[model samples]
Target chain A: MTSSTERSERAGAPAFALPFRVGRALAFHELRERTRDRWVIVISALFALLASAVGLYGRSAEGNAAAITGPSLVTLASLFVPLVALALGYDAIVGERERNTLGLLLSMPVGRTEVIVGKFVGRALALCLAVGLGLGAAMLAAAPGEARTLAALLGPTMALGLAFVSVGLLVSTLVSRQSTAASVVVAIWFLFVFFYDLGLLAILVATEGAIGDELVSSLVVGNPTGLYRVSLLASLGGENALTDLGLDVSLPSASARGAIWCAWIFGPLALSAAALSRRALR
Target chain B: MQRLTLEDVAVRFGRIEALRGTSLELRAGEVFLLAGPNGAGKSTLIRVLLGLVAPTRGTLRVDGAPVRADRAFRARLGYLPESVAFSESSTGREVVSFFAAARGAPKKRIDEVLERVGLADARSRLVRGYSRGMRQRLGLAVALVAPCELLVLDEPTGGLDQDALTLLWSVLDEHRAAGCVVLLASHEIALLESRVDRLGLLARGQLVALGDPTSLRERAALPVRVKVAPRADADRDALVQALERVGTIAPVRGARALELDVQPSRLLELLDLDAAHRACIADLQIVPPPFDEVYRRLLSEAA
Candidate 1:
């Protein structure tokens, strides 16, 4: 029952505390909304179904079952992670704007950066949880020794989700309409998950070895999906499918791969914050 | 906050100017209303004050100390947008609590605000289940949940029913009584005329008139109307001749009556005529200039 005067005085208490509290409140609200919409459950179920099928299929096939399953899981995750991440984040900001809630939310004692970061944190957590549960279930169902490889694959899968979700947020900020943001998100997914590697391979074929292995390696490391595949494949000592395609895909060291993943996760998020700051919330 | 001032503030969206060098001040304990036609920049001005839109020129000051509308500055401000929306899946209580926590208000204040907005009974229901009026009430609950030095509401009465509108006015009164600066943009001029302390009429991004209702009416100097019904056997021609000398007279439809539009200065003379013609007039009623009339006149003048 603190009086409003007492509460008003607290406004000057600490700058850090207010943003942190506001960010946490916004994040929790986002998580609650997603949970109520069954987004977490649906995505988790989809991942579990797909991951189990991929795991069982890889176990029946080839040399070193664990190594095979690990790369196989990474491949599955690279495709699904971007799609799911984009779906979760495509309308994050634009949807609010469309619903006419962005202005009210912005009017609160919350920073624009806090809004973007809070949403990212919330969706990232949901993504990690859903993917973790699905992959965890798959790992448990795997043969005893293969569980380690699946476990090792889980972190990179979540990182890949973070990277793509950040990209989705950037799209949400740039577009004014929710439908446009959604369309752009789909385009981004297609470009990254499918067309990117196809275009790279097309370049190799088109150039006829004019593009050196060093340059192709740099290109591979540039895309989040490519980095996820190379880093996990290199760490698990599994041969890459791209290498098998006669591309001579040399993977960067684990640390460089990790650093690039960090950049992927944060770069678009920074841009989104900048875009939101410049936006007229009305 | 004793005084919040917008010093010659102008906001431009690309080549189009939304607000043009408009200066205004809102003092504590006063309910200031912004009235304007569509595209008159009422909403834009509100956004600028909320810090959602930065002014392309000029400054915003709180109590004579210039400040940016950052989170710290907005900390003491409460706002309800023209259309208040929340997640359909969230319950009334959850929505209120989310905003309350974001504003750093105590948790107990959530229920208090819900009760204040008459949503306590519906607190557990999802927003999707709430009626539009209920949704507006929930929006008001969120805005009022935290204590604020300045409360800004845009079109707050849009979806509100009579009961909710009455509740809103009462809550606004409480805020004003508590020395909160209540700034609202609304088209409910007639309803708000008596309640608001001052009115700013914006036409084409300019404040055409700024004063309380009485002063605004005086400034507009629009004519007042007097409706008169003549006796059955009275000489209507003679009554019209006397009324015409005082003011312009027009026939009242479907009645043996005449409507007189007279300037305020001539109202006493018209009333004296009505008194002299009481034998011929069965009824006479004087209608003062309404707030709507003043608003229309001011806007037309500015246009």
Candidate 2:
């Protein structure tokens, strides 16, 4: 007989792809594959060497661990970590689509949420490893005393990195072409990380310091990287820099910056996950 | 066993009707070959079965129940897309293992599927260096790793060398023997005409014809050709004269033989070489319209 009768007589149903294990598997797979990406590897190595050099140089120059990764490290990390995130994740979804591997990956019993979340988890793991190995070397090269400060600094940098990675994923889902995604990522990275503060500064100058403390605080918290930079002040750097930049207010406290960091970390990541899940495969 | 039934399924991409309302059934234990010209919506239909593309309207029921593309539902399917690719830096073994885990299939399947696709030796070689045929084999291995209620392969045979193709056919044959449905969309279906249980011809987003080879031949309404080959150096006219008794004869293209469009029923009689005809004719060949011709005629007719 044909299929209908045979299907009726089948003994058992097939096993499903459990979300936890599948997501974990995809995470690891993505991590392993990202290791092959020249950009990721370069950034990873770049962070490692830069952190170690800073730590060793600070050790010789000032003999203090805190001095090694202090305000300078925070500023440099603010500039570098987001680059790592965007460089690695800019093509997360659309890259697979271009390689034609997205269909293969999605054709399995795994869900769209699994793909996005698992990728983030994997990239996050890679981000931590890169930061830990790269910057960890620097801390180790210095006196063990500054481990506390380094931890504080790494936490927000990683959060900032994750925020950018999530934005990259959202860009991947929002566009079909890899070039477009990469371009969008560069524009976003430049605008928020490098140029937004300057644009805000220009506004401050044009208004003759009329931009009030509350307005400055809200504006800083608005851009993800800006939020990341604010989080940086709480990590290790002092808040006087914001005032000199014409903020005219005290730097945000640690708890408030923590909240902003959490928002920045989860906000884009969640939205991108939603976008990926809602977008049709075909 | 699985029964794939599409009831008036249609897909619209903005202004383009990629697939129109079309009803069809692919029963278990049959190799259903889907054939069509470019942009004929064959790929779209295949995607619908794989659950990659949802139908704009109508129902796709697997075993009498409407299904969505979910983990449980997709677990019952094996799909191989037209453009097969993998991480260039990953070894064949790593690539297979990654997919196996993603598929939730056992790690033990790694060895069996690799052996089946004849990639055991190249398992350690990175996919970047694999030749076209080897990569195609890897794709086949990925599809064969999981147990599937329905096997959906879009252009599965493209780029496969003879050895790889033979292995793929054997694997698919085994899949059919297990009573699972095998749906393939390939322009090269004519090459496996003898093995295809049913042929689906899609044109302009419509299923133009669906049948076994003989049924399609009947639907196509094309003639059967009978060729009478002469003994070496024998008179071609004598063979022609002999065939003229049954039907009008023409020269077999580039051969020392005479061809006739005799009724299929009378081919055996024409083949019987009695003493009178035996002197002129050495052998008789009956040629029916191949699937490719039938495919072209079906598309043109539908158009």
Candidate 3:
């Protein structure tokens, strides 16, 4: 029998020698799989073409002096950014578990943290590459002066995309099966992007301008997409343009600031990673 | 000897107690077969040991240290889940490599195990196209690639022909010779009888029996069959006393006149002695019940 001291030594055994390295290895494995998937390539091309068309249309309209305002572009980005995020992240966790690869990954020396974090990073990287392709296509589609617009919106757009992906990963872990998770994520998409905004509009109409100060600010802060839309508006319409447009374009709030916007994007991403890491494999 | 232990282990799914008050120890170089039918808690037990499921009420330890939170404990253990699945839509080679990377096996060893499992030629083909037997072989390859201290296999040979079964047994034999502790859970009793050194029979989350194969068969209390013809002044009472000393036996019934069922292997000595004295003038047969009867009888009686 082992002594108490020996028991303690074994109790304090280091997590593993290769959890992080293996996580990175898994990340690369995910990348290889993602890159080889015909769907990813197809979606990448589609997003690129779509972003390119939007960019070209914006540039042509600017030349003709019939352009959509900077705030309008923010609204436009809001429409599609969450779609991409939800589509990719929703299946990230549940699909692996459904396909039975999650068990294989969990059986390794690595902890649950590694598997979740690694997959998040891997999926995020795939999204980045896909969005980058879209941005490249946007660049080619730009006419003369729209390169500045693309540059200004690029980082913020990618950050918003990452935030959505994190949310999807979180939902994936929370649910059991792939089909159920996918369905819930889609419902979440409808609620957040479509219905929630519509409800907010109803609230705005009832409250009118009297309650706009505190309530409008709180609502915008609570919604990451609204915050991102506001940020993108500022990038397009000059810094003080949101203040000038009043609630018509975006709300003004203490937490609606740019730093808070960054936090909104990173918060869920961090939480999803944490949840995935800390939760045990079923 | 290194020991793997579970203390007051319990697993529950909502209100259902999949495993309750389950605790056992496995030692290095011992082939411990966990025999149970479906829903007998064998799968749940194996999952807990593999670190896939946390025990609701107790702790899991390796060498006397808690492994519930020990990630490295997994590295020392190799697992073959009941139904193996792979991502990347990969060929057999890629699937094996993924497991090798997870287990920290040497790059060269991956190829060796693939060849050992008879998947060397099919290594380049996508696993999506593999047959059930080939996939099972691949699963075995994954479990064998690493130098794990403990190997936990759930139905390792669930789908295999006799030839494929031989290949798996051979691989297990190699692991045995190398002194690896193997904990296998299977409903296939005939296969496990020869493969495992000890058999653990579980029913409704309780360990009803655990011992070497012969000991288990003996403890099962099911009579072993023996036949003999009637003899003149044959000390029938003495024969009955001698057989009763060995184990419980049935009365003389059916065609052969005097037929007794005793301990599986113990009857041989009595028969040998009787033959030496020129007693058994007919034929002999040893019939054993299928292993499931051990659980069927106990579970039913308990209920």
DockQ of each model vs. true complex: 0.52, 0.46, 0.28
- Tens digit per residue, CA lDDT, model 2, A1-282: 234333323412234334466688889988898777888889778877887788777777865554445655666677778888888788888988898878777777777777889888888887877767766777787657776777666776787788878778788878999999999998988998889989988988899879786887788777767776555554343556555544454456668777777777677778877877666666
Clashing pairs in 2: A48-A134
Model 1 ranges off by over 4 Å = A1-19, A38-41, A56-68, A237-247, B274-276
**TM-score: which is higher, 1 or 2?**
1
Ranking by lDDT: 1, 2, 3
lDDT of each: 0.85, 0.77, 0.71
Of all native A–B interface contacts, model 2 reproduces a fraction of 0.59
Better-scoring candidate (lDDT), 1 or 2: 1
For candidate 2, write residues B101-188 as lDDT tens digits.
Answer: 7766677788888988899999999999999888888988888776777888878887888887788778778978988889888888
The alpha-carbon deviation from the true structure for residue B225 of candidate 1, after best TM-score superposition, in angstroms, is 1.7
Best candidate (score: TM-score): 1
Across A1-282, the per-residue lDDT of candidate 3 in tens digits comes to 344344234324323444376688777776666666665677667777777777677677764211352344455556666667666677777787787657666777786767777777777788778777777677677765666656666676677777777788888887888888778877877887788778887887787756665677668656777777766666566667677666454545444466666676567667766776656554
Give the C-alpha lDDT of model 3: 0.71
Clashing pairs in 3: A113-A277, B224-B261
